[model samples]
Target: MLKPEDFRRSIVHEPGEFLAILERRLRAAGSSGRAGPRARLLEKLSTCYQLVDGELSKAEAFLKKIVEQGGFYAELFKLEAGVEPGEVLKRVKALRRAAGNIYASSRSELKSARGERDAREAFRAGVGRLVSIYRRNRKTLSAVRRVALEFSRMPDVEGDLRVIIAGMPQAGKSTLISRLTNAKPEIGFYPFTTKNIIAGHLPVEPYGRIVLIDTPGILDRPMRERNPVEHRAVLAVKHLADALLFLIDPSPGKYYSLDEQLNVYRTVQNMLQGKPLKIVLNKADATPPGELEEACERVRREAGVEPLVISALTGLNLDALKNWLTGLLKTGTRGF
Candidate 1:
């Protein structure tokens, strides 16, 4: 499974640096044939081969993810190739084959060699072949490196219930996510505080986990006006959200007017295509009593659903919200 931390470590560089790192790891993996029985040496050799296979397999998986789930990266790949999604797969296969050839050659040499010295020589030859393959496929490896880095910026969310916290800039989505889950997304007062999707998890007993995603703050404007990062956020809402908490700012100094916020909500609602959603009136603590009432009435009249009122900053009514969500999960309502 892809965990949040995987994003930090998944990017593999070009074959040159990658091979060097693998070589160091292999050397530190201990002598496969250190002054032991022949069987022991063979066992070590097998383990080493498995290690190489495993690492290459992981690299291949990363490439596949870039091609499949990297969003903009996948689009770029398609535009560059003018083909379907199999180009990266082809490159991954070629890289795997090169690594496999080294392992096969090394295993064969070890089987035929007479002594420990010869076995060690065979292993050295295998590492040399790995370096040679990397150098020969420098171009492909370079492309892989670039794609890996590009894709690493996108968050990987995993859980039973995927809940997206989305709203206009400064809508308290980040604060609410931090309060509801274990993720501490950067909290800022400025617009576009969050430029990418940030993921967190809420563990509810007997109901498994809920993956909470804090998406980038989107403006109340046409989709064409949004940047690529905001576009990715919209795509996440469309594709990843099993449920959504669409936050509406009702504060007097809110960046966008209540009507503009509602328009953005409608845009997201349309994008979601009937996925479960909760229209949350955030910043309730700061909103005036009359203004909050007006906003509530307007939301109900406009959306035909009563908006949930809560102050994410003050933790007001948050427990009740949690209980309500828990009930939804238990009943499997709204396809939770």
Candidate 2:
């Protein structure tokens, strides 16, 4: 029962050791000689891992051999660890793009609706596109936009401001979501605890509605396959964020390493792709005073963007964070 953690720990500094692990897994997974296309592909990937850091010529030769054999792993291996840069680019060009066209068109339609084109039909069509656009990209950003758009159309939920609580898994995402909104998300101690997206509302004054999103944590562990959940959750924030409450944990185990935390943050940041990104440091109670300053410094250096600090466990800074979230939604700036 070897896990990805084993491979990551073993290969942190040595590619050779990593290759050995891959070979052993491939063999154990019944991807041996003369296997099915899938198996053969896995076997080829094993070989690619073995050859990754060797001389460029040697790497090129190994990859060419895999292409000759042909299998699923051939494409995956080539894109991820292919020896030749040109080959990698060729593979990338051929790869099926994710979340294509639908959202882009919706974006254009939204702009058209906002401009002098203020046709009632245009506004109706603009928000209608959200249903199609966001069903696949469920997250706070998407959820908020959908809610806002639909709310505008309907008489019921209009004026609901988006208050997003975003962070990696186990970073108090659910706790904050529950505290801010009426939505209840499954809270757990493990990584990637929430598997589904949960929506709730915040009770504010005047217009007084808040969109609270409880999203599954983005696991930062070594990935054997692309995380579609992570992709969807990230895309939600990227395309749909109004205001973000990003959480950071300075605990031991996987996420404590600033590199790992930053890596997950970058994925979310890339998903946001220039959307307003705010930072919040979670788990201050868990962060010992001795490590607090150092951890904050690490977060400042590595987190994709900067955010405020709050302790979901002790309710420390939660009020301030909430007020900031409210003010941001109301005034279009979180008192920045």
Candidate 3:
């Protein structure tokens, strides 16, 4: 249940901005105290060291926490941003080392200072060195920021029972989730409408709660061939699924043919790794009887399971679907 919101709020500053802010704060502090010039210079240098050290330490800790809690957020950054958490952690450690070196050099320079002017010069030199280090690793910090933003947008799915609703594009996965839980994902006629992972909770009587997650449309293709939206679905299924509801659109004018839908289902099936799965034939209210029957037969013959026929649009057989899910929660079997 490690989620994006669980991460500490970190604001990444650009190299120049970070340097400028530190210098500005130091100057303001240096001008205020009534101590001798040397004492004030020492105060400014100490303040500068604290500022740089604190920023780097907090950032390193944040990255460490994310890597330690490797779950949905870590996989998500890998899939979308191509930024590995370990690599980012290494970069942060590198920056910390550079800052430590600069601070050490500054301390040595101050110890040998002949006058106030020498201390002032050493302080400026230290600030300049830190700025140079940050500038050299700008791309690394940018990647870190991108990962942080993506994590912030991820949906929180902390629950005992997580059921992922997955299918081809234009399948009624979003509508079905809205029907079952309080999550009202944007419903649309076009493909790939549900672009993000949406989580909704259903609190049942006697049993506790079920977290239903609606994922983006997954195409019938290999993992390498999937787009980011499709990868979102895969990540949810791979990491968060306790049970899965693979929806199939059986309408004559369905967005994808039953075969293609089944292919996507097979792809997800492999990702399930033994999680209970249910094949649902959606759009029964719109599908002709022949198409529905053919869809069910194909699922049984090919996918080796009885497809639960339900009209997510008309609320048909939804009670049966709910009953099946609640039964899973009750018995903890979640058997298909």
Candidate 4:
């Protein structure tokens, strides 16, 4: 299986790098052979041909795993259906076949040459053939380059338990993650500050490790209206989360009204598809007592679950919330 991090390490060479690697191998082979001069040249060319074909094979295998194993990249690949995956595969195979034929034809010419000058000319012709092969496949190489960059930006979330923080914009999801773990996601006072899914880890002794995910704010609107970045956040919530912490901002002057925030809550609840969830009322220190009580009552009435109140900024009631999470982990309960 391909984890999200695998994409970063996978090699997607540029045309120059690919050709340079083959050229270096060819030169090394030509210089290292102990056989006669003619045999040495043939050996070098054959080795260079094998090196080029081998790299293509490796690239093909890597792409196949990324597309077929089914992870974040697989989903993205499916979305880019217009850029047929088969086309990339076909180009790779064709490039390899053309390279093999060039090598074979060059080898025949080298053998048929009557003198040293003729053999040297054949060798130069072989190098030209290799260059022509690369030129013909330039577009295919560009496609691979584009795909590699797309996959490299994906977040790597790996652990035994995945806890995703989801809420409307400016709901303190990032702050909560910063406080809970050592991971420091960029913090801002504005909406949609977190544009991607950032992950952190909480090591709870005697229980186990918990991977905490901080996702971009999900607006209360139709899914089709959301941009690609927001859609990626939705994908994290839908596919990556084991449990969700839906944070609610009840401060009087918050960006979204209480009802609007709750609307997003309902939207997220539906998106979770029965995943475990906990509604947390964040920024309690900023909310007035009367308004806080009303918010709590509203959540209880609408969500039918008692919400946890904690100020991520001031650390109020955080210990209690942590204990609650520990208890949940200990009991293996799905919902609170």
Clashes per model (N, Cα, C within 3 A): 0, 5, 0, 0
lDDT of each: 0.75, 0.51, 0.83, 0.78
Residue pairs in steric clash, candidate 1?
none
> Candidate 1, residues 60-97: lDDT per residue as tens digits?
77657656665544554443334444665786688778
Best by lDDT: 3
Candidate 4 residues 137-195, lDDT tens each?
Answer: 66666566566666666555666577889998899999999999877899998888898
Expressed as tens digits, the lDDT of each residue in 1-336 for candidate 3 is: 556664537546667777788878887876866787766766777777777767667667667877887876678767765877778788789888878888888878876799777887987887677666767777777666666666667667877688999999899999999999999899999999999989999998767888999999999877788889888888889888999999999898788887799889998999898888999999999999987898899999998899899999999999999998998788775433
**Pairs clashing in candidate 2?**
141-240, 238-272, 279-307, 279-308, 280-307
Error of 3 at 292 (Å): 1.5
Each prediction's TM-score versus the true structure: 0.70, 0.48, 0.91, 0.81
Off-target runs (Cα >4 Å) in candidate 2 are 1-159, 221-224, 253-256, 303-306, 333-336
Number of the predicted model whose TM-score against the real structure is largest: 3
What TM value does model 3 have?
A: 0.91
